[model samples]
Target: MKDRLFEKPLEKQFEFDEEVAAVFDDMIERSVPFYRQNLDLIVTLLLRFLKPGMRVVDLGSSTGLLLIELARRCGVEVEFIGIDNAPAMVELARKKSRALEADVTFLCEDLMRYDFGGADVVVANYTLQFIRPAVRGKTVQKIYDALKEGGLFVCSEKVLMEDKWLNKQIIDIYYDYKKGQGYSETEIMRKREALENVLIPYTIEENRSMMKEAGFSAVDTLFQWGNFATMVARKRGK
Candidate 1:
């Protein structure tokens, strides 16, 4: 289904509701820059670090697309768990997983409160920005604490530039990119307004600092395009 969610007038703030979930796959692919390529980069990085029987968790795993792909390609025995607060997304993800016969568990739960146990790799693809800034630091700290020694936390986020003029230019470029993806100007504006306060983003440097403060020994960008970036943070020690 195409993403026509914003074509109609929105009565409430943007959310991962049933209506949004219905077309989330389309929405993500079109709205996000280098969506597929980012996922591929994540998989590639995970492949290098994942070991047989290790645990992998995806925070805010809407639609379970990444988990399904990982389950198919990882080949090695590993536990794949997807956590999403949206019940609609969780159901759709589970249905898709069953249809594909992929061994992945999709849980409808709050990521902040969920006990991650100890995972070899934890991924948060465009997830952290939605969290309130006040609690975002504590959330990253929790993710770090949930990782096993030498584990990794890979995250992708929509970032902002520190330079106001540069940020505006990049945003215009991004809007143009959306237009090229077949989204109408109205749709773009509507969605942007709907997500105004709901999706708060951080600067790339701010994101890196948060991870470092959370005790990640090293942090590096894996891919970047305009205002979007994927980064990896490694937990030190064997």
Candidate 2:
């Protein structure tokens, strides 16, 4: 695991630490209904190929939400490793993982530096966008190399859309939804700026091409909501 990934920078990534935690907690507790409404569509499309006892890695796992769902609710006995760069987030996630009794571990390591030697399922839920574009290809290749033959890589992300009108509409609706969930406009702008400063999001087609270049076979979108999408790709069985 790369220690430098956890090197904290001086700039404030979040305005208030407690507020950040509150936002995350509210999202988890109150947003379950929204997630449950879409879980079957997303999970079925992403995990249909997965089997029991396969080791999985959750890259950029925040609060360990998806991994817990996969382990406790999905009935998979796979050992899970959840990696994130935020120490505070990792601590919270570790506590949750312990409380849930899920087969999971949390590591405060950079996704770019982590050695993924035995991953069977690699998940990056809204996290890969933070990777620098120049190194993104190498990161995907690392994921490909880390996987055993026929392993699955699933990612859900907010992407850059090509159509100008559609892109504006997507951003509008996304923030509108966020506002409806009780975030102030100031808070929403701050969140957007923070993400923009960190994440180098790509177009859907660009991501597909990158995955293919990284040696993934059968890359395809499993679910899409405007700019947000879920995709699954497979490593070729040798």
Candidate 3:
């Protein structure tokens, strides 16, 4: 299914419902800036760090395509678990995983209260932004606590700039990029309206600050385009 969801006027705010689940793969690749490239970077990083029997968890795993592909390519017997709050998304992800016999587990649960059980590598691509601002820091802390010593956390998010002028310029450039991806101006505007307040973004600095406070000894950005960025955080060995 293609992303014709926003082609018509939205009946409700954005959500990971059954309807969106049908076209999410197409929607993400076309809506997000450098989405494919960022995912490739994540794959490379995961390949480098994955070890036998290690637990790798993905927050908001969506369709679980990333883990499925990684399972197909990965040589190690690492545990791959994907957590999602949306039942529809989880169902689709499990369906896809079962089709390929991908060694991945899809769980429908809120990440905020989920137990990670000492995971070695945790990923949250375009996930944290949806969390409420008041408790976002606590969520990062939970993620940090879930990891083992010397664990790795990779996160990708849409960031906001404090500078109003530069912010508008970046958004303009991003809109142009979306247009290049084949979205009509009306589609774009309608989608923006749907995502308003539903998708809250933070500054890159704010994200880094949360990681640092969460006990990640090192946090560095690995990729960026317009307002989107991928950051890697490392926990120190005790």
> Best candidate per TM-score, number?
1
Which residue pairs of candidate 2 clash? none
- Top model by lDDT, which number? 1
Compose the digit string of candidate 1's lDDT tens values, residues 1-238.
9989888887989999999999999999999988998898788778877789899999999999999998988869999999999999999999999999999999999988889978989999989999999999999999999999899899999999999999999999999999999999999999999999999999999999999999999999999999999999999976
lDDT of each: 0.94, 0.73, 0.92
lDDT of candidate 2 over 18-51, digit per residue (tens): 3454357565333222545454565565466567
RMSD from true fold, candidate 1: 0.7
Candidate 2: which stretches are off by over 4 Å? 1-22, 25-48, 74-76
> Which order, best to worst by TM-score?
1, 3, 2
Choose 2 or 3, whichever is better by TM-score. 3
Residue pairs in candidate 3 whose N, alpha carbon or C atoms collide under 3 angstroms: none
Question: What is the Å distance of residue 84 in model 2 from its true position?
Answer: 1.3
User: Global lDDT for candidate 3?
Assistant: 0.92
- Every model's TM-score: 0.98, 0.83, 0.97
